[model samples]
Target: MMDENDVKELISSYKNIKDRVEIISNKFDRHNVKLVAVSKTKPTEMIRILYDKGHRHFGENYIQELVSKSEELSELNEIKWHFIGSIQSNKSKILTSVKNLYVVETVENKKILDKLAKSLLNNEENNNNNNNNNNKKLNIMIQVNTSGEESKSGCKPEECLDLVKHCLEDNNCKNSLNFLGLMTIGNPNATPDQPDFKCLVDCKNNISKQLNIPLDSIELSMGMSHDFEPAIEFGSTSVRVGSAIFGERDYSNKK
Candidate 1:
């Protein structure tokens, strides 16, 4: 549904947002940190244009939206998709079924991990490619409830270690999932120094020391459309940026 002019506009928009994020990240020399453009409700036309402009990483919050986009845009070979949303138990299989899904940024407990692990294994089995685990592994991040907000879905800080250990102990999960590090959402109305973002950084440090995993090897996925700059300042290795790049979502005429 997009013309060439619309494609150029989207590319221009993506460059502007990415430049701003880079300006902030450069202050701390976070050259390798990623900007996962959250494109949940955005259409394939917009996403494809950005993909054409060399923005490889894109994120989505809902499984159906993600699957639809991936299916529609299957012609693009190098698009890296991120599931930057809350994973529903009933839709775990569908979420993992996305062909280009690069990271699952909402692993809060062993149950979701167990379900995804089973799904990943089954998928590999069905493909008759069980011998090669490298191609089937899914990257996952443990989300921490730093703010203790009742509305947020994540594991409490106190319970994070136990959950991480459980995920590591399950051979299938450990094999099927590449435990990246941690992720947390910030309150939009809050200031740049969001305590929740800091909590995620600290949690990752503690996990690295406790589990003997290299601190650099573990990444922190924090921040969003509103607070990504602060998240980068707080040692966030990756940010889930959405509206800032895609513009505001229109929730009209829906259930």
Candidate 2:
């Protein structure tokens, strides 16, 4: 249960985050962008308050935390869980099994794709037998390394088109994985028109044209606490902001 102080803080954080998103978004044509409250590392009590306050979308970076939280918050059927971290082959099945998993935003290569394919294939069979057509397919986003950062887990900008093509058309896994659009962690210091964000915009256009997919139908998932405003200006459909909404993370126990 949240104490008075905790409740106040959560309310303040949610309002600030919402206001910023609206203020920035009003300047753009596409103001329908989503605000993903990144609740990774934060406790469910805190997340619950935000959920109670009407923020249904939450993002998690780790598998264990996401699964456990989803189960814990099972009563709130409206919560949308987003897996925003690197995909591990070992954890693919667990990911596929997550209920209310609205989107996976970090698909980078063929190996992870193959593992996910197996899990999704199993899901298809199970759903087919059960006549559960509503949950047959899953939404997927290609994570492109627009910043060209070596440490980041994303496909290189040049490699993104083929990865997209593989997911959208050529791959056998398209039935289960609906390749929606693209995502990128733009360079923190770069301007909206610069390297990272620009690459994402350009890459999406090229790929959509190449695949004959309507460019407008593709969603761009970019921006975070420090850079969402510019990301909105650059056509980001959703911004993942954690610290700004959940306060600074408690990293004392983190490795």
Off by over 4 Å in 2: 127-134, 252-255
Clashes of 1: 0
Per-candidate clashes, comma-separated:
0, 0
Q: lDDT by residue for model 2 over 1-255, one digit each (tens)? A: 768987898889889889988988887766689999998888889888988888999999988888998989889899999899888889999999998999999999977777787798888788879988765678889899998879898998899888877776645578778887899998887864667887899998998888888988899999999998888888899999999888899866431
In model 1, the worst 10-residue window by lDDT is 127-136
Off by over 4 Å in 1: 3-8, 129-134, 253-255
lDDT by residue for model 1 (1-255), tens: 877776766677778878878898899888688989888777887887787778889988778888888999988889999887788888989988898888898889889999999998888887776464545689888888888889999999988887788778889898888887888887767655677877877788788889998888988888787777888888888888777777888756211
Candidate 2 has a TM-score of 0.94
Cand. 1 TM to true fold: 0.92
lDDT of 1: 0.83
What TM-score against the true fold does each predicted structure earn?
Answer: 0.92, 0.94
Best by lDDT: 2
